[model samples]
Target: MNIFNRFIVTALLVLFTSKAFATSPIITKIERINVNTILVTFDQGIKPVSHFDVPIEGEFSVKLYTSTTYYLGSPNSLIVRTPTAVNPNDNGFATQWQWEEPTLTATDNDGLSEITINLNAYHSDFENDIGHSSLDYINTLNLIWQHDLSITSINTLDTNEGTNLEHTLIASDTAATFSIIENTSGLFSLSGANNATLSFDGTNTDYESTTKSYTVKIKATTGNDTNENTEQTLTVNIKDVTDTAPVIRRFTISQGVNQGRLIIKTDTSVTVYAEASGGSSYTWSSSDFSVIGSGAFVTFIPNADVGTRTIKLKVTIGDYSSERVLKLKLVESHPTDWKDKNNNGINDSKEIGRHNNELLVGENKKITSPINTRLLLGIMSEDTAHLTLAQMKKYRTDNNLSDNTEDTLTTGDIYNYVVENFSATATTQVIIELTSPIPANAILRKYSPATGWANFVINDNNIQSKTSNTCTDDTHWQTGLTTGATCLKLTIKDGSENDTDGDQNNGKGQVNGVVESTISIAIPAASNSNNNNNSGGGCVYNPNAPARFDMGFILLMTLSAYYLIRRRRCFNH
Candidate 1:
């Protein structure tokens, strides 16, 4: 061997070792810069030779860094892009880069020997930094809303209050909360889960004269992250409803007399009713609380004073109201047809028991003795009579009384009565006194279970009347019997003296015999004739016979007048 050959071999070995050491890159640190990017810092300036080798899982680019010259004469960093979003939980990612990656290669600026880094020296540090990749979102994280947050429904509601509107919001984050950002007139509020409710407070409902609609702005957010929230505006409309006024129909009195004007005595309470429509509430008021009560039906009680009282009733519906006033008269005493001859307030004849059995007729069109001990009389229509006819027949049948075969009594208000505690003998008598004279068109009849209905027989001499006469003093003889003849007097002569009923006890009173009498006053329909049939008395009391006789007389008169006119014309010719 030659000395030159050994020296050359030693020199070649030293040169190759120096070149390998110079090309190797020493990594100082490895870190993640973004969700898809990684940064590696070296001990010296470096240049790219081969792209980074990454796991083939998704779309990726291997040419993350490509340079022919050093960066600023000393490139010490390398930036690598990931195939996809890096999963912070993947601990084997650095393992792949230290062992599986092979294509990634780099060299010095002189392009000497190629070198490949193991990357295992930076495994712990790189993995720790990659686990916090979500922190890279500090600069570019954005919120994405899912829906438009618009409500699409008929928002108009009637002026009637208590209406609701609902709307839902969707955000990329499910933990978002909705809130009302701006409310017009403070009329709208948000509530319920997720603040999905949009409610309107019904304070004012007048749409025609006030604001008709409202607007509000809503926002959805998660905590204080304003960048990840959304906002929307909502509107609600109102509709107007027509308002109508209430009406009062009529007023009626349940007690006292209603002769165009109401008349009542002290200690008498009359129930007054105000019939109305289209109202929501009823209120009654009076200056004197003691004289009237409240509501649609009020009790009017007269005090110990004689005069008039005013009561008012008001019906209200919403904003509309109607009112009515009533004037009632109060009296101190009852009306009677007796005379106070001794200057005392009491009737002298009444004190002596002469008029004790007499009954004063009331405006209810009824007259009766105390507790119906003697008589009960009332005036009613044919319909009312029919309603009571069944009861009357039942009573007769139950009491074993004779059957009624009488013709039906018709026209006017039928006056019915039962006489009790009276004798059927000629020694007993009854008198029917009226406030006004009996009309000439009226006729009196008696209905008996045994004899049916017939003209009531009476003594004309005992009859009395009063026509258009006023009694100022107690001695005027009430009914003006001296002025006309409106008072009818009935006398009983045998057991059959107008004994129309066979009750024996006469309803609920003292019983004098095994049989009693019932009286009825009936008027002939559309007739003004007097009946001539009589039983024992001379008084003729037929109300239907006059029409036929008058018609015949009228025909004869008309013919006679025609004949006279023709004869007179012939003589003139």
Candidate 2:
């Protein structure tokens, strides 16, 4: 326990601690190229130091320069040693060593000599080889190096270990090879990556009917390396052929009337027939037709007497049958009557029998009672004098009248009594039933062939006269006539020639006579009463005139006063 013993022990403990816990050589700069290659340079200089009382050189050695190599095992290792001997010419000299396994080897054993060696290590295409060769090694004595390393061995490793490597080579040719046997179903598919099923039939001749395309991939592995075998899909297009036959449906027949004519008064019944294919023979039946047959023809007759008639024609074709109906009609003929004798549906009798006796008789028959008598008188006068007695008798017979009736008169009687025996200066009277009131200006005209004269006289006075044979003053003849009142009269006057002397006769002559007869004028119910304003004499009466006075005298006095007043006013003004 003395101080000397303490000094000696402490010195020994310091020496032992220095040897046991030596300072590690710092890697000042370490550059790694890819995953496999690394370059290291030291910063501190080498100094001779003692360990365990032995002389040791300040040499640096790279003991564990670990990297990955494809041909080596896990964590493939590299060890580098540099000698401590200095070159005789330099005082502060550092050694630098570059190493590549199997390419270069170190000769100095002192671990301080400068050495360069090439290691056949794995290299990536992106690594710089020149930078890996120039690295400085300083006083790095026996540097126990530790580094993160990757191993890419030639032998196959587990999936977890090989997944970290950047490059792996696979035995692509020795791996499984897949070829498309057949794409039975025409669809796109991949092998290994995706399996597809095809629906194509191999036995069919149209093997390439549809294009069959597939991807073929090969897999190969050598130890831990893997290679991909890729191939573009091959498309096999199958060609098709025409082998089926064309099909057609059978032909069918339907019967109908092309054109038919039917009489309006007679019955028209027609039969429709039809025929079709797909049968050896056809049996025909119809509800209307009495006859039945086993041929292709079937007929259906319909009873069409009036209006339209339809008959259906049916034909059977194998198990199927079709039907068609035809339409026909029977129209009534045109009617025939007294007005439409031609029967062309038009009343042409009126145009054909214009002015005939039947037409005249029909018009004359329409007149009632007293008018009928007047019309018969007028017609009989024209016919009796111009026709013989037998002719007049025949005319009466045709009109459904007795020839010996009291109304019947002979032509000789009309000529001798009404025309000859009656004086040309004499006048006869005949009464007419009245249906309306007579108009003021109404006149009567009578024809007298015996005297070669016609007379027209006003019908106002009961006593007839042989006036002038003109109707100049009769413009208002239709005025003042009322319904249900006697309205018209006729006065037949003799001419200058007399049947007695056959020449002009004066006052004592048998000519210049008058035949007086009465006629009834019918006023239609729809006629207006104010239309009686028509005046015949062209004279207007003064409003101040007395109502009891004659209209003719008032009109004259008014005209005279108007003239005198106009003259006086002219003088005064």
Alpha carbon deviation, residue 101, candidate 2 (Å): 99
The sequence of per-residue lDDT tens digits that candidate 2 reaches over residues 191-247 is: 332222212222333423343222222223223433233322232333333222111
In model 2, the worst 10-residue window by lDDT is 408-417
Error of 2 at 278 (Å): 99
Would you estimate the TM-scores of all the predictions?
0.23, 0.15
State the TM-score for model 1.
0.23
Residue 12, candidate 2: how far off, in angstroms? Answer: 99
> Model 1, range 417-464, lDDT digits (tens) per residue?
434333223234455454445555455665555455666555643323
Each model's lDDT comes to 0.44, 0.31
